[model samples]
Target: MFLFKRPLISALFRRKIQYPKSLNIKPLITFQINKMSTTVTIPEKQSVIYYDKTGGPEVLQFSTDFPVPSDLASNEILVKNRYSGINYIETYFRNGIYPASFPYIPGREASGEIVAIGSDVKNFKIGDKIAYLGNQNFAQFTKLDSNKVSIINVGANATDDQLKLYAASLLQGLTAITLINEAYNVKEGDYILVTAAAGGVGLILVQLLSKIKKAHVIAVASTNEKLNKAKVNGAEFLLNSSELSYDQIADKILEITNGKGADGIFDSIGKDSFEMDMKSIKRKGTIVSFGNASGAVSPLSITRLSPKNVKIARPQLFGYVTEPEEFQFYTESLFDLIKNGDLKIDIYKVYALKDYKTATIEMEGRKTSGKILLEIPN
Candidate 1:
């Protein structure tokens, strides 16, 4: 539960918006999971994008008669969503590449307001603005464990729209944060290469690695426009992944690093980028294959690492944020950076929740940049 008590509620609910004057941020107040009764307004059934079988986006069927939970677990909170983020990973679930149960609601992350809370819920109350990344969040209202949600403090300075952007965008930002800070700690002056640098997580990685960690970031994208967008986000160098072959890109990276090669490579574009990732890093450097945007990287012999002491890691978002401490650290750190203006959220397109199929099409086609959002109708 770990919900904040009344004394800390003022901090979470600011009356006036003012930016913190300095980066000397205070630690978040700690609270235990406690239970309390709360009254809420709700409906018995709601519309949702559901699927009875795994397939493509075509399999998704919108229905209005889906039964809403009649009871909340003591540790649960109910959210009426305003927006949900669309990630490529959902396509994996929709396609049966990732195992899922039938009649599934296919969404992983959303931003909304708490409309109800179970008796044991203590920190969050009805009408509190919040956001969560979890399963079955594609519906109009989704129930979540109190521990698995974040309070979107609409400080006097941040508007509801701004907080909604934070909610829709945090998942990718957190992924990038985990990639750089935890999976492979990027150091000052480190030459790091990021694939799909104009894409959601890649764009965030470019900004954070270059601006926050002081790393030299090289961006790989599909077009000149995306490359320029990455440049604006602090990418020092660029390579059009579509224009050049992987081998050529690897060679260019080596040339950029003055033959020493990149100190580290954060690759989300797997498959075609796999061998290049191995070839592009310096001796003893690490290559993290965090996603399969270009499809899964086929199995490689462990002996490949023996050549130049190259290391490859495949880290997942769920694995990194499994611990409560780590989860809070990453999510809060991301929000702090946003509030401090160290990171920016670029939402390239917004679609109605009913247009999810089109959103997935654009996302999968790599036709959009930054983040794509689905505005859940009230």
Candidate 2:
């Protein structure tokens, strides 16, 4: 499978972009560039971590001579990445479980400043601070389709810490946002269960579901420390997944919910938690399987779902934001929550780009609590 997603606006920008009535996306706010703050210089080559044949983190090689793409499609924008967010899904690609093109660049999300913009780009300009989630990342500099970019206003006076936090938090933060708000439509007074609840996405889900939606959040993690972190983030109840079998986990969930089970169960740890997730949800409750941290869940027979009248949904971020307008709406809303202090970005660790292997090792072992990040040197 091709690991890289094509630029979002690469195809649409060739034609006239239009917004559907349902989206209600405001017109693109074009920022005019007057005197350029600094004439950002580009290097002919940039360092990147790449793997020719995927296997383990050891396969990744850091090369300073990696050639930067000189060609730019009309809708593409070049960003000088300050920080790159790491996700476990990238490890799947690196381990060859997910097919990828040879010499793959394994990063998916980042925050940076726009050093260059294509001629057809309208909504952004040079020096604009932006964060993006897409393919062909894991490098000091990356080119993103204009539509895929999220503008982060880290004005001239912004500090390096502010930029790093926003950039590193984008993927996990936005995933939690869309998952709670759209994937399962969490509402007030619902009982929600989150597997791997102390994880990057899990912590955010706990905060959003409990604090924002007024839902009862039951968090499951492998360690007491993680579970405690979940509690600090507003999880009302906690269970250590490592301490209980799937059936026992289900039983505990039922006890917490007064034998009714959870109204919504979000399972990111797929294989081990699949059975627990099914038994822990109430009739007609929604079960959203978003990740496969433990291992991929096998396909279930329809009869298994019919017995409980439960609804199952597997949501991927790419599928949710295929429409430019919907993507814009979600991105804006997520950032707005951050701006209003309704959400906090909890970053677990930051490593230099050259320390890619150690970073992946920590993430794969589940040693980190929140998002893992790569700090790209300017």
Local distance difference test, each candidate: 0.77, 0.77
TM-scores, one per candidate: 0.87, 0.88
lDDT of 1 by residue, 205-226 (tens): 9998898888899999999999
Quick one: RMSD of model 2?
A: 7.1
Give candidate 2's whole-model lDDT.
0.77
Q: 177-269 in candidate 2: lDDT tens per residue?
A: 778766788768899999888888898889888877889999998889999999999999989877887789899999999999999988888
